[model samples]
Target: MFVHFDRPVPGWEPADGIRTLVFLANLAAQETTGDTASSTSTERLVHRLVGSTVHDVLALALIDDLPVPPGSKLSDLGYPLVPATGDDDTELVDDAEGFLLLGLPLQEDTGVVEVEFILDAGYLPIPGEVLEAEGKHVIHRLLAEAERVARVIGRNTLQTWLLHSPDEPAGTGEFADLLREYGYLPGLTEIQGFVDIQSNIATTAIGESLPQDASLRAEIIRDLCVPEALIPGLIELYRLASVEVPHGSLDAEPVEWTPRRLHQAAKRVVTTERSMLSVLLIDDSGVIGLSEVTCHPGSDPDVLEQGITIIHPRARGRGLGLLLKRELLHAVATELPAARRIYTSCASVNSAMIAVNEALGWRVLSGGSGWQKHLPTV
Candidate 1:
């Protein structure tokens, strides 16, 4: 039995939120050791973003007749009812199995639906064949809802994308296998790498001097707030960077980072209390190179994920990429005293950025693959 809602389950409470945080933390620990954060930190985060309208969130829950206490596991709940007709008058069940959430950022028109499955992985009473059938049914219901929303939002097409661990790879893990069985084709293979900056800070000192005629100055933006005046420059620099090494997408398409879209993203990061540290290299012509890293509050506060490092085409051949990265590393070490390690991912074909990361002493962490399914337009 599955119930889909536009928001969190109607009767969801604080206890359920805590249970969810615990479940997710445990999952993160399994994927990467020592990556889990304290409950206190996570609780603060849940309170902040639980009601956010920044994304169109859809949740699928399993429900049954039993009355369960708050924070109980999904498997412990009674069996679910058959899929509903997905109308406004759908009955709200009394108790629900934990849910799987899918969200699409309202700010970005990319039409990529991000997945966040919050259900427990414990076994159920159904036979393997029956369970598989139930899983397919869940996927279909979710896709149908996603497509409806896309149509309402005026999108001609959309995709559902998720990342799986290296061990799972493509066509192997349970979820991956399920998606493949349901027509979600595998996409990009990304290589993840990490470095313990405490011991490897010296590695960032590449000793590459900037070109004498470049006249560029590098500065750190600790507050994640980009001044209104610099937005144009940042956009230009990002555009040039994308042309050289485009941002990764399921279809390997380029992104047009408009001012409004960039501002919206920056606001979201700031509101979430996540650190978006950037080092921008500016010359008289404006921003020519940029490097960024982000760390989400309550989720391995010490682990910063590398965002992007880009240098204008004209700025290339002058070691600007290394210069910008080194500056960014210094900023991270100074502002984030708790920072211990930084992780970054590069597409299997992105040799330039991979070389930059390797030059900074980053070792391979794991491999991840993106899987996407294109939804048919009605």
Candidate 2:
């Protein structure tokens, strides 16, 4: 007869005459390694056999932890329980009426610490099935017993059961009803899903690049403050570069990089250079304004020439781009006297950035396309 149980008992065995099946499986592994083998071999065998059983027990324990009315079906605990089978019949025994007990290993230090229950899915009554009084009592008793078993297992516990007919309408109805009855609150459930996705993104290298400056970074915390008009030009530049390189293309000009954020990033660098006597550049209206160019104690001479830019759009036509770049280079040599190779990236499509860099004798370190995906919550 199909038998089911959901509690831990001392020296418990399955009631469906399958307890020997599990014991023999464990025995086979032990025998293969030789009973007289080293301690490690025996330990490995024991862990493999027991670790699996523990998971089943923990699954049940989790179900038992759910807050539900006493007469609820096993499925009403937010997860379904399924039957377990083994080869041995003699060791299996029907216990506490409809309950069947299965053997689980305990660490030596903690005697018989955990018991795993394998329920008979066929015998377990479903919600709205008009379970007899006896069947209801048995389920409640086993659930109560499961709580004690969980405590014995230790602070962390897990239980797992397989559903034989998950796709069947009967099983689906029971499963869905159970989840609704005992699942985490709606808000909490949504939060858990968000945490799962966000945690992974937070680990990427790009995500780690928070502005180094704390105070100035607050100004451009959101993308809306960025100049929306410049976005079209930026996107076109990105698209042209993609065509030229066919690969590594920028997916789209980032909508997140606001002018305030850029200012904050620049400010961080400026603050660092201030103590070390470095140069800063602000280009606007086709004119390059030298914000700072100075020499400081023990400052490297090569960095001074690297801090310069040509204003975009307006600076495109006049040869003023080359003139501004050359002037900055000269100022680095005569003023700060400490600078190194300049570095910058331009869209492969932006001949202007490329020309200015070339005129200043800057070599292209690397160039590639980049892409980005914007995710919106539904």
Candidate 3:
């Protein structure tokens, strides 16, 4: 008797229902594998993102597994059913069938779709198996909603989609097999709860200057500043970064960043209240390497996540990635002394970067390939 919608219902107070579903999905790891440590962290980060960020939320019945309230219609949840095979005589807000599908945008202009089909979990009862006809029905429902919303928002939609599942045996085993058949592969693994440890700045070699390669130098950007002078460098930096995947591989849509895209990205970050820092490597020409870190500062100390840190293939012989990371860490330590924990995710195949992070005293989670740096004190 769970209800799913495109947006929070009329009287839902900041919707604990959405939070509950996220918790349930993540709790699967603890239940199946008994890994309380990572499960706790994943859940915490998910709830934190929903609370601090302006993310779109759907699926409101996870609150307590209750039925849709009486006299409440699908339209009340921000989803209006469109008239199918009609001559324009019907309102799209008609009653829905038994199952409910939900969606929200991952980014405003980016065509990524975040989908949650509660039935897929089988906490209640799904007609068939997880990805049988019933599960596919829910997926198609979400896709339709994604297409409709894309048209209204005037953004290219659904070139990408996120299908979140608990890190349980079922998810990694049979359930994942079904998703792969549908062209939805696991893209991220959540590395959850960790103890914050004090950074040992005394032995840290952060301030060591990079080689004075007459051609290359480094700079850190704060407050979303893209100096008119460095715009070209910034563009190049993003172009190089978007290409290099976790291992020695190229991204599907590699080389997608343009100067226009850069500005659009900066505009969003500038308008938002979060903190972002970028470390750029520049030669006499333009940006050849880049690393970034971001965090949402709150009343107490906050955690920071390292963003993309990539070196152009042409510029990789000189350990530029390591240099930039050290510089980025130094910047974070100095600029955000109040930061509690810093973490970053990398592909399991990327051993080079993992080694560098390991040397920095970052703790690595076993199940997932992510490293976390804790700041027990400012």
Candidate 4:
């Protein structure tokens, strides 16, 4: 017999179906906390191991379920249903009968919780015994369920698999050979051509500085949403010639720029201790332009230019975009040179920005289908 019950997270709805499968491992096990005579230290360890393994599988499943629209929230989907209590003897028996049947411990708690999970051979995409090994069934089930859910939601399912745990097997060559027999390959593939900050700076610098003139400087300030007091004639003198301004060069018409949003974004860039924020600008008339937001690593300053847009339409054009970016890069190199390798991502479809980044020597490091999934409220 199976027990069905509901448990909700405060201020968050429960995950249902595949989300439940993906998140079940993270859910606090009923036996994880609170006093329980039913659980021994060994049993507790087994619970943790099993829970963590399931959690990882579930995460992949959730990723497969995400919708295609950018920035879709989990709340937009139907809440997941929490698992029923597993502490009872009946549920434990059910668990043992299903996927948890292998390596059944004759004397758990007194000894180790011994069990091996089985993988269904028919479901695997890769042909090999490694994927067919025991304990792989959890991952197989997760992938199968994720694929089913993806089809229902109209999305493609990505492949996900599990390999044997490296640490637990000790130096037993047999266990290693067994995992190898299953042909399990660990880790995801690498992405190429992604831009790091050092490359961005070198490529962006055209070796031509902004011209010095009070009127031109004023125009530049007007284009950027900076405070008038912050605008100094000498600011133009420090202009690095190599920086390439993309938006300012675009033929798009000028848009209204707001100071409040600019100030807030600037504040965030200046205040964040970690290299999670950057400021960029673009100018057209050799005067004012659009400012942009970005981030880099705190430890490795060279990894600058994680682009995040804080300013929207009002500040379009004006070259402030590249200007802010140049200024921030200069600031990091001057103030925090120890850091290396900046990283950023843009939609594969944004041609204008992609052109600018290409000129700056940024490359595509990784690319995959972006998706979003939604569920109506119950």
**Predicted structure with the largest lDDT when compared to the true one:** 1
Candidate 4 CA-lDDT value: 0.32
Best by TM-score: 1
Q: Give the alpha carbon lDDT tens digit for every residue of 1-378 in model 2.
A: 222222322233332323322343334323322321111222222222333311232322212233333443353333333323232232223231333232343321122223233233333454336445554444445534554444444422222221222123221333223323322111110000000112222333321222233321111111112245443433343334334322222121222333554455345344323322222222322112221232222233333213223333433464544544444444344444334433343444556656655644553322222211122222
Report the candidate with higher lDDT, 2 versus 4.
4
| Better structure of 2 and 4 per TM-score | 4
TM-score per candidate: 0.71, 0.26, 0.60, 0.36
lDDT of the structure predicted as candidate 1: 0.58
lDDT per residue as tens, model 4, 1-378: 111123322223222321333223222111121111111222222222233211211111212232233332232124332232233222222222112211111211111112222222232323223334433544444334444444444433222222222222221333334333343222222121334446546644422223343333212221234555443311342231112222222122222223443455345433332233323333333323323223321222334444343222344465444444555555445445664544454544455556555655665443322121122222
> Order of candidates by TM-score, top first?
1, 3, 4, 2
Each model's C-alpha lDDT? Answer: 0.58, 0.31, 0.49, 0.32
Question: Candidate 3 has what TM-score?
Answer: 0.60
Error of 4 at 37 (Å): 48
Where model 1 places Cα greater than 4 Å from the true spot, the runs are 1-15, 25-29, 32-54, 65-98, 123-174, 203-214, 227-229, 240-266
Task: Estimate the Cα RMSD of every predicted model relative to the unseen true structure.
Answer: 7.3, 25.1, 10.8, 17.9
> Against the hidden true structure, what lDDT does model 2 obtain?
0.31
Candidate 4: Cα lDDT at 348:
40
Superposition error at 19 for model 2 (Å): 57
- Winner by TM-score between candidate 2 and candidate 1: 1
The TM-score between candidate 1 and the true structure equals 0.71
